[model samples]
Target: MVFSWRKKKPRSFNGDKKKELEIPRHFLCPITLDLMKDPVTLSSGITYDRESIEKWLDDGNFTCPVSNQVLRSFDQIPNHSLRKMIQDWCVENRSYGVERIPTPRIPVSSAEVSEVLFSIMDSTRRLDQCACLDSLHKLKKWGLESERNKRCMVANAAAAGAIAAAFDAFAGESVDKNINVLEEILFVINWMFPLTEQAQLYIGSQASLHCIALFLKSEDLSLKQNAITVLAELLSCNQKYTQALTTIDGINKTLFHFINKPICPSITKPSLTLIYDIVSLSNENTTTEFINMGLIPLLLEIMIDSQKAICEKALALIDQLCETEQGRGFAYDDALAMPVLVKKILRVSELATEYSVSAIWKLSKGDEKALMEALQFGAFQKLLLLIQVGCNDKTKEKATELLKLLNPYRPGLECIDSLDFKNIKRSF
Candidate 1:
């Protein structure tokens, strides 16, 4: 019960096995208390494991984890000296099962990022295909290095301008000629998420957006996934971009591809989210576009087959869409809608259950046909179970109301989902 790995242990069976030795306190990360594999120093003058500190900052904490001092700058430098010392310690204790840490590559610096960005622009301006392609590849590698590099690169105000200018260089080039470079550029731009400031302006224009739309229609799923995700972030940054997205030639239909015939679930989530974002911005007419695109039936299909997380998202979208009269009519028309909604009442997750029940509640608000459908699809029984089992107060209210709405259609037999309904007796 009082075992400790820090204390030295007796030698193992093999004579070559050395006695386990305690790891020096200084060699351990202040945060993790483990030997630092990739030690990095924050501006607050405290060292931490790179992953740990980045996670701390990423979680919205601006203060140093150990010092608890506010960090003015999120920038951190690799504690090369500390890392080397830890590596040596690992080697010195290798016989005790301590493995040597791999040497981390140097973090890309601001100056290097600037120079590479300049190289990309210069190569594009000079029509140096080889040079531009090479620089694009290099920049993507830096983007791939770490999240810190992405923050650094995106922080550069010219990053968006650089990407747009490079894209303009391919104005007349055939798609196949520089497809790789095009993909790389998208990859780099995507890394600069949570687009703060006016960075979105560079590609938010009609021309730039049209180009992105082309990529969205690309037969390549990887390229299309990147384009939709990038568009999703942009829409999140400013709903103004929605106009340019909708105006593009059949671009709205391109988004439909991911949700309609999703080649990858990765693409479907954003597809649903983007639709939600767009509908949230505009009115029910925009929901009409989605309905006309045959989104309702497909949504029901995704909810039935997708995993819980994806199903939750699909359910939320459905609930949002049903807020519109036309959207509600479409859902009511779909045979799967009531059945799927009834099945998801207490199934899936809390959010999914809420969305499913709410959608039904809204659809059946003043319609006798819809209420009959709910009962025909076993919505009465599901709502009964939802009450017998415990749920949040808000959900309980909705379930109770639905049960009341369906009480006239309740079965003649006694309840079977539970032995009693004492918990919800007041509602009855």
Candidate 2:
């Protein structure tokens, strides 16, 4: 049976096409007239679904829907009796294909949030791993139920504080065994974002961020991405966080670890983006460290197989990294670097191709091996083709310079004839 916005007619087993099962009027919200999944009574003593009343109030209506009187107070109490009655009715009408509404969860309250966070912090402190996991799981359930529940937890002092404390307890311990416990805590913390003052005091600390960065090595892809995302959120809160990120021990190496391993794009995008941002803040010493930690090879790895967006991200980062000698030297040492850069010249987006061309110009400057690598990979042919297709002035200059270098190597190379790029479709 079709459900109209104003009313519902769940089909009954009697199978009379036009016959409708009569529903009790009190079971419906006054505003929607649909069955109330979570009934609540307002200050006017008029009942409505909790979701409907909240939206009504959000829409700036302080008057009761039924009484049309200005509500003196906005407090809404759950109508448990009516909600139970509705559940019972839905059960009795199961043959009519109505789904019994699952009992509505009690919304998270500040005091209850404090209690759960206390459990997590206390259990972890005592090393009672099972009890700690149970409490974190409980809090995670509430946090996942609704946005309202998340706001309540974020408002609680213990919520973010305890999460930071829990991680502190296991900071340097081997993560392989506690990955499950870590995942649960991390997910709930993720929900409590736009960190409040209390939350930021703990999560924004360098100690806490270092602990969170440990999960970048997690073999579990989703968990690793969650860790990266959490880091991104916290780091975004303070520009100085990037400066702090560079100082953490093995932090750069761990971040580079996942980039070398080609995970899904969801993981790669944020991971690479964060890496790029952090490196952008690097001084001379930090830039050398990132290169030594496999930043160059990892970027080549990403550019080799990634889609347009990720490929462009990798190229852009490489272009920035190439500004330093260590970046250019490290990239030159990789045999695949020139070929990868040359291949991307005209294949990816205009910006990606431009970055590719620029990096090639920057890396091959006054270098024999780099220039030969570009020539060996047919960079000369691609460069000529890029110019004939009409590039930005800067790119045209770079492409023209690359052509001059390659001309000595492959002077016979010319743009491919009659190239109708209008029909040449690229996934990237």
Candidate 3:
């Protein structure tokens, strides 16, 4: 069926006389030389159909024949009108020709582009106003539309120039003035999770823990480092933001998942610091969950493998854990395994002896059998060695106190000692 559709002609450049332009071969794909085809996406996510075009794209050859500049995704084609025009031209040409072909469209002009830009800016401004007024209903509606708009904007080039202006405005002082709006902006950038997807997307997956994990997985080290700093800040005021961490599945999963990843020395140190903070906030339920999930083993592994600073942080967490009744229960429950744990602690290169001594002290408060077992394992020798080796002054004081508790006294000696030693001195 033949269909008649009105086609918009390309705007002409200023000149007295019209000239017929010759199409460049470089602009044509060698295999298809008739523009490009199916537009298949490559493994690397770049889109191209022709082998030569794909090679050029892969080899960092990114320029529009029309624009003569580096062609980013949006720069290649910038608006729906242009995109539709290209598709229509392809269809029309195929109807009249024996060869199946691809058609390319011309880029749009600046002034027509400005009108679209103003409309988007106006819409964004309205949404921002709604967000400022806490109109979640309107915000949600506009937010979804904005995302749809993003897909188009990402595919368009001329539209992008206009959109860049909107972004500049979005990032300007006016948006900064609204703290809530700014927070909303951040949430959007983080890809705000719906309640259902929140668990699987953020909590269950490793990337869900922090945006940094995503960046890290993608090998964006700078973004990953920035994320760690942000995580530190998030955890620093954990008392205020505890709900955000625990209530969100992704946040909770991400925090725990880090325990299992190969520790980066840079991240490990800060991670241990965060662990200490989490331990400090531990309740019976949280501590039990931590213990049940093998937190102890992971922590012990870290202590044995990590640097002194990390080991110290681990020990501090253990100290805090043992201070709680539930934590004491965990210690006692794992007391049968105490000898093995102590072995690992002793094997640690840095601060092993110090942590071993502390572990012994903590175990002493566990079951009687555990205490007796600890003593039998030469815990006293380890403790004394730590003290003699210039262990922290506090550690020395604790060792002295524990030694007093472990020492045995004879009944007869106690009586003789209680007697008036000064008065009996002459007789002696």
Q: Give lDDT tens digits, candidate 1, residues 1-428.
A: 32132343322222255554667777776666677779988898888888777777777888876667888898878888989998987787777777889998777788988998899888877767788778877777777877777777887877777876666456335445766676777777787677655557766766557777788888887888888888888888888878667767776687787787777877888788788877777756667988899988999998877788789888988999888888898998899998788777765677887898889998988887888878876777777677776677877888888878777755652233442233433222
Best-first order by lDDT:
2, 1, 3
Best candidate, TM-score-wise?
A: 1
Error of 2 at 190 (Å): 1.9
lDDT digits (tens) for residues 1-428 of candidate 3: 21111132322223233553332333233334444433443333333333334445555756532234455453232233433444565454443342334442232334433444455556556645443334322333344644433333333343333322323334343433443443333333223222122112222222223333333333444444444544554455334334344444444344455566744666565565555565566456666666666666667566655666666767666666666676656766663345544553333443544555566567665355665565555555544454554556666676776666544422222222122122321110
Evaluate model 1: give its TM-score: 0.74
Weakest ten-residue segment in model 3 by summed lDDT = 419-428
RMSD (CA, Å), candidate 2 to true, equals 6.8
lDDT agreement with native, every candidate: 0.76, 0.77, 0.45
Clash count for candidate 2 is 0
- The backbone clash count of each candidate, in order, is 0, 0, 6
lDDT of 2: 0.77
Give all TM-scores, in the order shown: 0.74, 0.65, 0.41
